[model samples]
Target: MAAANGRPVAKRRVRLLGGLAVAALIAGLGVFWAVTAPRAVSAERLAAIEAIEADPARGERVFWAGGCASCHAEKEASGDDRKRLSGGLRLTSDFGTFVVPNISPHPDAGIGQWTLDQFSNAMLAGIAPGGSHLYPSFPYASYVRMSDQDIADLFAHIKTLPASDATHPDHELKFPFSWRRLLGGWKFLFFDDAPRTELADGDAQLQRGQYLVEGPGHCGECHTPRNLLGGLKTDQWLAGAPNPEGEGRVPNITPGSPSLKSWSAADIAYYLESGFTPDFDSVGGSMVAVQKNMAELPSADREAIAAYLKTVPAR
Candidate 1:
């Protein structure tokens, strides 16, 4: 059947037409999946849930160290008090805006029902529980280095958090970037299975920094730029990159990168504790939120992070 433009019309024409269109769309979707899903899973994918069920207490520590709650959960509860890992923090970027998802333990809306392997894949592989590639905004690149035992414990603690049944806002990304299936190609370009295998010798401070930046802190997720394929631009490591907040830059932290070099290790540590960078300028943007998390950590760990920063080769 056709509209008033004068095509033939029958009593059941609308129903048949709609059904055929849906069938075609479904066929197209099937084809799309056939092309996309295989690359999302790696042969090295983690094995089971039993691994993550150990040491809930230690997992809680890893959660804090990893700063999971800062990004996954809302900074403040909403009127409905439904902001625990239900997602929906809009992160604007040059390519697109992303809404962070709730990772709380809500059975229906959160990670409560995710199997251990599913959690492992998301953290280690940046693929969601269903084998779909997650946007790098989740920072699994840094997370991939995390020890399996630690990851498992982290998941255990996550299960104990208060659940929120809140629904999240859908991401309204722009063209090309909006095609989630294309993420497989993006993952191939940026994601890797090889974890950090070595650290700088003779520098305990540097090693600590390396662990914090690459693992729990995940600073590179925002501080590093992406190549054409959306992988972190390692050549420009920590040299400054655009952030979703206020279009402010994640300033270059490398020694001579025009941002952090002038500050002493003490300056860095104090700024972390009080949100005051050198020159008395207040830290802002993502760093503000980051400091909130850092302030909660022990003084020694924070200082260790500072020591590590000092060891970064001057740019």
Candidate 2:
């Protein structure tokens, strides 16, 4: 049998089967590519949103809350050294060693040229200026919860940091993980920019605490255990986990946990402010850096964090 324009047609059934297979293949490829494609923060949306004038003073507060200096400051730096945002810290993990990038104000080396919009994308959306996916190691996943005003202020504060010409080597990651584009696939599965928690109307202090705990503070990134794919187990929240960077265990902050059940909210606040456990033991490990950051916060903010933590369910 011959069709009007075809040389020959074996059978309509054969054609239908072949066409279906081709369609399925195309559909599969399309889905694969779509899931693998990296997404960027919408520049148009960023532009349309009204940003408050950034205040360097306010940004200093945000900087402390976000703990930017812990990672960006020179390794083993103390005192005045921490003010310099010349990143060279080496973070180790199962995936590989990540060499932190320079985030200083140096035009050639740092993010000096990055626009506010680009910084927002980097901090909140985990997208770089050139639209590359930043690893969750940078903790932008938690930063996503930060307010627009905070982001603006933080950016202004960062700009005021002294410029450094220091350069660091690229992240030394193993196969597949070393590929930056592969992060698109990871982002598809885990990256979410939505609000992590919701609070009732009013109660400004509690609300501020919630923002700090869930946002720039990024408490869960360390405290929450991760799934096999490296996504945080939100159900567990801050129930604690084995540290991926080392052998130490990340402590559970939820009040329900027997470990922290004895400690009152005031105890938590005091610890945050002074790095002294209820037992009067000094803080250590990765938390040392975090405690230093928390200490910089006002006593009110620290108390607010404690108040918010008390509201969380014990695991």
Structural similarity to truth (TM-score) of each candidate: 0.78, 0.90
Candidate 2 displacement at residue 94 in angstroms = 2.1
lDDT of 2 at 111: 91
Clashing pairs in 2: 256-314
Q: All models: lDDT?
A: 0.71, 0.85
Candidate 1 C-alpha lDDT tens digits along 28-130: 8887666566353344546543534578878766776787766766755332232256676778766678888778898888888998878877887777766
lDDT of 2 at 271: 95
**Any residue pairs clashing in model 1, and if so which?**
85-102, 86-102, 87-101, 87-102
What digit string (tens of lDDT, one per residue) describes model 2 on residues 91-201? 988789999999999998999999888898888788888877788899988998888888888889899999998888899998889888778778888888665555655
Candidate 1 at 149: error in angstroms? 1.9
Prediction 2 global C-alpha lDDT: 0.85
Candidate 1, residue 110: Cα displacement in angstroms equals: 1.0
Show model 1 residue runs off by greater than 4 Å.
1-49, 75-83, 193-199
